[model samples]
Target: MSAATLRAAIAAPAPAWGLSAAQIGRAATLALHDELALAPKPGLVSFVDSGSHDDMDAHTFMRSLFSLRRYFVRMAELGAAQVPFAELERSGIAAEARMLAATGGINTHRGAIFVLGLLCAATGAAQALDGRRDADAVREHLRRHWGGALDARSQRAPTLPGGIAARRHGLRSASQEAALGFPVLFETALPAWDDARRRGLSAQQVRLDCFFSILAVLDDSNLAHRGGLEGLHFARRAARAFIEQGGAGQPGAPAAAWSLHRDFVARHLSPGGCADLLAAACFLRRVAREP
Candidate 1:
C-alpha cells in the first residue's frame, strides 16, 4: 500500500468499516457471483463499523444494495425455469435454524432480506420490469390476494393471524413466519406488519403479502438507482482506504466470520436476498484472488 493510501485510510470517517461506494460496488459483484455459485469463497471483504452490535444498519445497507441487484438476477433466471415455487423449493433451501444458530443474534429482517433478495433476483424476477410498472398491478397480484389473509386472530399470545411473532431467546428479536406448519423464508421492512390482526389478513397471508410489497418497492428503488449507475464513480483513493483499513482483513481474525459469510451465501442469499452480497463478494474475490 502507498503512503497516500495509508494516510487516506487513517483519515476516513468510518476507518473500521470498509463501506465506501466503490467497495459497495465490489460487494455487489461478489454477492451476484456468490449467489450464482460461479466463483465461490470470495474471501474476506471489509467495511467500516463501530463494532457495535446494537443495530443492523451496517449489514442492512449492504443487503439493500445487493438485494436490489439480485432481484434482477432472479428475473433473468425465471425466464428459463418452467416450474412453480414448489418445484423450485424441491431443489432449493428451507431455513435450518440450527445452522443459523451459530450466528447468535442479528437483524433477521435486514439480513434475511439480503439473502432472500439475492436468491430471488437470481431466479429471473430481477428489476421487476416485467411485473408491470403500476403499483396497482402489483397490489392486485400480491396485495389483495395475500394481504387479506393476515387479519385472522390466533389463540397464541404473541401471535398474528396466521403467524406468531416471538423473540428468539438467544437471538436478536427477529420475526419468523410459519404457514400450515412450515417456516417461510422471506421477510419485509414494512411497519404495519405488527398490526396484521387489524388489517384483516391471516399470518400466512400477511407474510406473503408483505413480501410482495417489499419486492415491489425494492425493485422500484433499485431501477432508479440503476439509472445513475454508470455515473457513480468510485474514488480510487477512497477505494484503497476501504479495502486496506477495513476490519475484516486484520490478519487471521476474520476466518470464522468469513467462513460463516461464505456459508451464508450458500444457504440464504436466495433469489430475493443476496444480490448485494454476491456482487460484493465477487468483486473482492476478484481483487484478492488476482495475482
Candidate 2:
C-alpha cells in the first residue's frame, strides 16, 4: 500500500480520541530516550555512565535515536497501511543504514531499531483499524499480521553478531521474539513494571525490578556473546537473587543493584537484549496510558 493510502486510512473515524501515528512514533522514540537516560542501568549505557560499552555512550545513543525519528514514523505509517512484510523489511534496512550513519558506523541501537520499530508499526496498524491500543491488542495485531513473515525471516542465515550468537547458542533471535509477539515484553517485562507500580515502588525501583525480571528470563545474545554461557548464567542468577530478595521493595535493593552493576561491568557483560525489552515495555506502557 502507498503511504498516502495509509495516512488516509489512519485518518478515518475511530473510537475515543487516541494518539496519531506520529504521536505513537514520537512516544516510541522518547521511550527509548528515557531508557538511555535511566541511570544505574546495570552495565548498560545511561546519561551518567557508559555501562559495559566503551564504543557508544549516551551522546552516541542520542544521535542514533535522533536519526531513527523518521524511521519510526515511516514504520508506523507502513503498518497503518497494512503493508506487506517485505516492505517493512526494506524500510528497516534503510533505517539501519541511517542509524549506522548517525552513529559513525557503530551499531548503537540496532536491536532497538528492529524491536521498537516493529512495535511502532504494530501500534499504528492497530490504531488504524480502530482496534484496542493495549499491550495485548498491539501484540496480537503483530502476531496476526506478521508472525509468519517474522518466522521466515528468522530462518534466514545469520547476519549480525546478535543473530549469530543466538543461532550458535540456541537462543531466540529478535525476529523469533517478534514472530511470537514478544512474549518476554508482554508476559514478563510489562507485568514486572506494572507489579512494581502497583506496589507503589519508586520509578527507579520499578525499572530495576523490570530489568532484573527481563534478565532472569530473556535469552539475551549480547550477554552470551560477551561472556558466553557462563556469563549469561551468572547474570541470570544474580538477577533472580535480586528479585527473590524483594527486589526494590527491599530496603537494601538499591545497593544490591549497584553491586550487580559493578559486577556486570567487571565481567564486560551487557544484557543489551533485555535493555531493549525494557525500552519496549516503556513504550507499551506509554501507549496503554493514552485515552
Candidate 3:
C-alpha cells in the first residue's frame, strides 16, 4: 500500500488515542539529532508495524529493531550506575538488572539486546547502509562476545510458540543459532507480534517470529519496568505517570495541553498501536487533540 494509504488505515479504528504520538515522535527526532551519544528513547511503547506498508520496509524494520536494542543496553547501563552498594536496594541500575535477571537472565537469548542488535547489524541490509555507526559497533562487539561473532544459541531456543514467529518469517537472532533452539518466552515477544500484525506481514509469516524479528523488541529493555518497582533510591514513585496520563482523540480534533509527550507522538509516530512506543505518545496526542 502507498504511504498515505498506510497512514490512514493505521489511523482508523482508533483515530483517537489516550496520548499524543507526536511527543514520542519528538523523542525519536531528538534521538536522530545524535547529540546525546546515547540510543534514542522515543518512548513509544510499540513501534514495529507489520500491517503498515511504509513501516514494513526491511530497512525501517531493522532500524526500529536496532533502536530498541540500543535502548535496552543504555537503560541497563544507566540503571546500573544508580544502584547503591551501601544498600542492596539503592542502585536503580542494579535493581533493574536484578529484576530482569530474576525475571529472566540478562544477556541471555531472551533477555539480551546485544544478541538482537548483533543480528540486525550483521544483516545484508544493515551492512549496505551508509551511516550505521551503532550497527557497525554492535556487530563488532558481538563478535568479541561470541568467538568473533553472534549466532543462534541452541541452548535458549524459544518454545513452540516463540519458535513459530522467528521460524515462519525466516528471521534469525544474533545470539541464537539454528543449531540450538531459543528456550523461553521473552517479554519482548508480545509487542513483536502486535507490530508484525500492524505492519501487515502477518499473512506472509506465521508463528509471530517473536524471538528475533521486530517481535523481538519486547525484549528491548526500558526504564519503565524498573521505574515501576518500589524501593528505587531515586525517581521513586514515578507512578509511570508519564505514560499513564497520555490521552487520545479523533482526527482533526483540538488537542488539550495534557502533556508534551502527546504532541511528540502525533508528528513522528506511525500507527504502531500499544505494542510500540508510539502508543504512549499517540495516546497523549489523542487525549490532547480530542474534544
For lDDT, the strongest prediction is 2
lDDT of 1: 0.29
The TM-score that candidate 3 achieves is 0.23
lDDT of 1 by residue, 1-291 (tens): 344653443244322321222333344444433433322122112243212222433344344344344333332233123223332232223222221332333323333333332233222221122323122232232222222221221122443211121221211111222111101222232332333435566543333233222322232111122222111111112222323443222344235334434542333222222223233223322322322
Candidate models: Cα lDDT each: 0.29, 0.86, 0.27
Over the stretch 186-256, how does candidate 3's per-residue lDDT look in tens digits? 22333443454565553222121222222212222122222211211111112132213321112211122
Alpha carbon deviation, residue 234, candidate 1 (Å): 42
> lDDT, candidate 2, residue 152?
88
Off-target runs (Cα >4 Å) in candidate 1 are 1-72, 79-82, 87-131, 142-163, 166-291
Runs in model 2 lying further than 4 Å from the true structure: 2-7, 10-16
TM-score of model 1 vs. true structure: 0.25
For residue 212, model 2's alpha carbon misses the true position, in angstroms, by 0.7
Question: Judged by lDDT against the true structure, how good is candidate 2?
Answer: 0.86
Cα distance off (Å), candidate 3, residue 10: 47
Ranking by lDDT: 2, 1, 3
